[model samples]
Target: MAATKERALEAAVELLGTDGVRALSHARVDERAGLPAGSTSNWFRTRRALLGGIIDWMAEQERADFSPALLERPTPETIIEGLCTVFLLETGPFAARTRARYALFLELAADDELLAPLSRQRREFERWTDRLVTEAGIPDPVPAARTIMALGDGLVLHRLTVDPELDARPVIERAVRALAASVG
Candidate 1:
């Protein structure tokens, strides 16, 4: 049962990533996952439920990869390098997930039920960013953390579509240094 649900969610991610949100449906998820006709519907009765499941799945996957200890005492250089690495992964290996996440951000902006889970994911990262910036000697960590997050998102989006081969390290390094220097 869990395996079937996992497959359905994976298929749903693929659909949302490749074909956009309009292509997502229980039947399409079943077909994409190669499960029986009722597999997706059995697990997620409504589109909202399926979207919520996907958001949860994404959060689970990300949580497994996150390491809070890494931000214990980070420097600007470490932050820049870390953000650049994440940017590369998002634009390259994790491009599909990135695209799907962006699609959901735009598609479900007005729906609080769906937006809540998504916001939780963002909030987790924001907290991490806050900690990193504060430890790295940024005087105002809150807005700086938000700026860093937005910068990473914008850079990832640009790399994914506008210029696939763009180098993100320099940009990240510049921004991180500027933020770190804003200690007063």
Candidate 2:
């Protein structure tokens, strides 16, 4: 049962990423998940509930991907590597998940209610980045963190959509190194 729910959510996310929010329906999710008909509706009775579940699932996946261990060491090398790993989407599953997340973000831009959780998640991530910059002895952590985040978002979006062939590691690493050096 738990597995079925997870599969349905995963399928929903994939659909959102590939086909946008309008394509998301209980039947569609069931079909994408390869579950029995009405399975998604059984799990998530309403479209709102289904979207909320997707958001929760995305948050969980992101928490795992950006584990504390990854951010424990705030050295420029670690930061650069971490940023590269996340923005580059070197893995297939991670890339797909990220694409879905970006798609959801666009859809949620005008939806304050749906964007609330994601907004909190964004603030949390910024706080983490600020802490990392402070630990690195950067005098102005806030601006540095914001800059890093902007650079990361730009790179990730570009990599995901604009130019799939664009190589992001070197660019991200160089930017992080420069930002750290400027403040050091």
Candidate with the greatest lDDT versus the true structure: 1
Worst 10 residues of 1 by lDDT: 63-72
Q: List the residue pairs that clash in candidate 2.
A: none
TM-score of each: 0.93, 0.92
The lDDT of each candidate is: 0.86, 0.81
Say which candidate scores most in TM-score.
Answer: 1
lDDT of 2 at 2: 99
* Cα RMSD for predicted model 1: 1.4
**What lDDT tens digits, residue by residue, belong to model 1 across residues 15-86?**
898999999999999999999998898888998889999989987877666667655678888888778778
Count the clashes in each prediction: 0, 0
Scanning candidate 2 in windows of ten residues, the lowest lDDT window is 84-93
Off by over 4 Å in 2: 90-92
Cα displacement (Å) at residue 45, model 2: 0.9
Off by over 4 Å in 1: none
